[model samples]
Target: MADRWYPMGVPSFSRLAHEVPEPGMLVAHDRALYRVIVVHEDHPANWAEKDRNRLVQNRRAVEERKRHRARPLPREVFYPSPLDGWDGSEETWPNRPRGVELQPMAGGKRLHAGWPHPGWAYWYPVDEHHPVCASCGEPFPCREVDAAKEAARQMVKVEKLMAVGPSCCWHCGEPITSRQGARTFPGENLLLPGGPSPSFHQRKTGGCLYAAKEYEKKWREANPDLAETADLFGPADA
Candidate 1:
């Protein structure tokens, strides 16, 4: 019923002629459920334009078929007939179309159906009971799953950093040893606020230096007065 309001599920298609349902309402057509996205009155000009395009497309398709029919079949098919050993029994010589082939079996050869028709042969509608998010239109529990994954990753990272010990570089999470140049920042660490200040290895590409600068920038923004007097960027440790 178009006049009747459907809270959920597919509405009757018979009443669609009386009144078109508003956008977002689900309707059943040819046993498949579809969500009506838009409703508008058909224009005569639009129909005429469509008819002209259809005629052009039909003519082009006909011409393509004629051209295909004119072309000769593959040379291999003519040189040796694919049906050379057919015994005239339906079981032995099942209809082997142009592309079908025969493969060796335990006793003899058996017909293989070959590849299926190109593209999707059939499409099944989404189950009505299938859960989906109203906001994102993604499968149900989308954001919650993503949030959980992120939390798990963060927990793993924290455990790894703990295993590396406090003397490790905050940026790369590796212990600062005598092998590489290391520098320490003297401000409140942005990653571990109120905790001990973190040090970073002076990588050749200055990646650690950039991370330190970013940390200092955030610290300066938080404590402007202290940042103005503090020398956060000190010389690298020998």
Candidate 2:
């Protein structure tokens, strides 16, 4: 059976950039100037739940843009404390691994792949011993088991931190400090250096929200052509 289409689902950005537009296709309502990357007729979601997630993410992006515009820029005097150790530089902080590149198999099927979550170890019982490698699926001796487990733990931690996305100071593009493998910044409600983190809602607003708003204004001014369409208008219905 073929997949069904819906309006407002997240369109693939990469595809949109490369492909030429076809006739009879409608430009995305969220931002009319930008054409839809993947037509709903072609890249439909597998289920309503997937559709809902895309809708929510797109909505959040709009809200964030609004908040970004309304908020003020970071003040020149505002240097995140040295004690906090987040210098706010992008050169120092790198984007996380792209994870597994997923594509549909058929009928809008999702492929199960991507970087594993960082908190995998916290879920495993350290006291109990398993001989088989959970990640690589290789057999190791009891002595090697701990080593493999530690390696697994390390990969998760590293990927998680990298997952936080670019490490530049959200304000000045200064390199940020990732102390003890923890990606720390000096602001609140801060759009994470990456997408939402596992501990997202739990994070205190720490003034990052204000910093983001300021940063948005600076960026928009720098790039006058980048339309603030979605920022001004909420995501639209089909």
Residues 156-216 of candidate 2: C-alpha lDDT, one tens digit per residue? 7556545453554433334445441122222232233334321211112454435544545
RMSD of 2: 25.9
Colliding pairs, model 1: none
- Model 1 misplacement above 4 A: 1-36, 39-138, 177-180, 234-238
Q: What is candidate 1's TM-score against the reference? A: 0.39
TM-score for each predicted model, relative to the true structure: 0.39, 0.17
lDDT of model 2, residue 195: 40
lDDT of each: 0.49, 0.33
| Model 2 lDDT-worst window of ten | 119-128
lDDT of 1 by residue, 1-238 (tens): 1322222323322433322244455543322345544444333244454444544554555456456765435873655332334453333332211122322212354333221122112211234465555776544334544566568877886675455458888887777888877766666766765656778777746477677667667767877877676444554322
